[model samples]
Target: MELQIGKYTARISVLPPIHPKFRITPEPAAPNSTDGEEEQIEAEPISGFTCIIGYTSGGGEVSERLITCRSLRAHGTGLTIGAICHAAKGFRAFRVDRISAVSDPHTGEVIGDGSYFSRFAVKSSDKARAPSGGWGLTPSRMRTLVAGLNVLSFIARCDGYWHALEDEPLANFIERLWMRKDWEGQPPVAAILDHAKRLAPDSSIFFASLETIFGSRSSTRLLISSVRELIEADGIIQDQETNWVLAMQQHQEEYYARKGLLGSI
Candidate 1:
């Protein structure tokens, strides 16, 4: 996690813990006594904070509610939560097992875990897809274009990986991109693309014409090659007959907007 939360940068670390004990059914010949059934069995002691592996809704957990879980945010009870993993709407993260002993800062009471998702990086302006005019690809098409193109990245020594933001959709990518205003101070689209390609070596950037951008290119062959590769396994490529210039402008504007660059469009 490269994001900064409050004063701390996001970090992942291993937390040492003990294995939990599972109850084995007693044999029928044993004298049955209900008195010992509710006894609590202690597990191994765990170290510091770490993500506890367990099933929750859509890979996350509900908030303010406990469901007799075997794990507790990978931490022992009585510790205040530092953060949560895969939880929908709870504190950054919390330990359910600690609920019995711990109290919420606001409520000052022990409460069941329930969903209370808060804190996200981006916001959406509209859910609908933009119209297809000029270079404007539908949200679906934009998604395809963004998904197929592998942006270049350096991962130190071992043949760097392109940071294409794979886990997020195009809209989300736009949200993050727009949030950073990365393209604001750049010289030109062509210059950036050229630098990215030259530096990364394995990168590929695609677009239709040189006229759309202010850069000078001796040939459109490279652009054509990149486009061909982008569309190779997908299927046939459809060309828009409308004014390519105007369409591309609209496409650029919409792309910027999707990314959250609210000014230009």
Candidate 2:
């Protein structure tokens, strides 16, 4: 299937189910809730593992089984799904940590999911693959780099000046981020920021994709480090950059809290 990604049309290929990455092994049964909650009748699990997915919509855990990301799959570190959202609608990427629960859609029976990400403490940079030049926008692997840039764009505008920065590192970052094959070849920095700000009002895709990118510990660290370097590069933090930097830091704190890691400012 082909999906319109930014200015380009990407042929999205769904990965095969038996590709070793989508296999689901039996998990230890979840302990019964001793508090005497009502039990639900178990329905036959779907082969695709389709179920009621309760996720943090940032408001709270929304148990929306009807909403699934396209090309859903789970690997060693993260889970990807066909996020049936109103934003882009086809598929929005998601980080599993933001997900609170998964349940049998038919009976509303809760199912405890995997814990692959927590097995490691500090993540190594090489744990996950780096972004490619946006070739096949296969429904499986959504663009992580563009998503990261979306986050930076949001931060840049948090101070109410949603425009391009004259700062060196930030400009360089924007320059590199826009060079992805799916985007128009590095348009004027000012125009890029303008477009992003315009997209801000209804850009749910921005938040979803940004959270998805942060699923990888390495990606989170890389983004945080870049924000630090970008804001400090000029050696003069303006009120604008200060707000942006603080937003980025707040996200970092939230990420730490979710991962159960020892967080530091």
What TM-score, computed on C-alpha atoms, does each candidate reach? 0.16, 0.35
Off by over 4 Å in 1: 1-137, 151-158, 161-265
TM-score of 2: 0.35
Say which candidate scores most in TM-score. 2
Q: State the lDDT at 189 in candidate 1.
A: 34
State each model's C-alpha RMSD to the native: 21.5, 18.0
**Which 10 consecutive positions of candidate 2 have the poorest summed lDDT?**
38-47
- Model 1 Cα lDDT, one tens digit per residue, 1-265: 1222222112211112212331122223224422231122111011111222222333464223211111122234233233322122112334333232322222233322321111110113424454322123333332222222212111110122222331223223333332332322322334223222222111111121122221212112233333233322224322321122233335445545665654221
Candidate 1, which ten residues in sequence have the lowest lDDT sum? 149-158
lDDT scores of the candidates, listed in order: 0.25, 0.40
RMSD of 1: 21.5
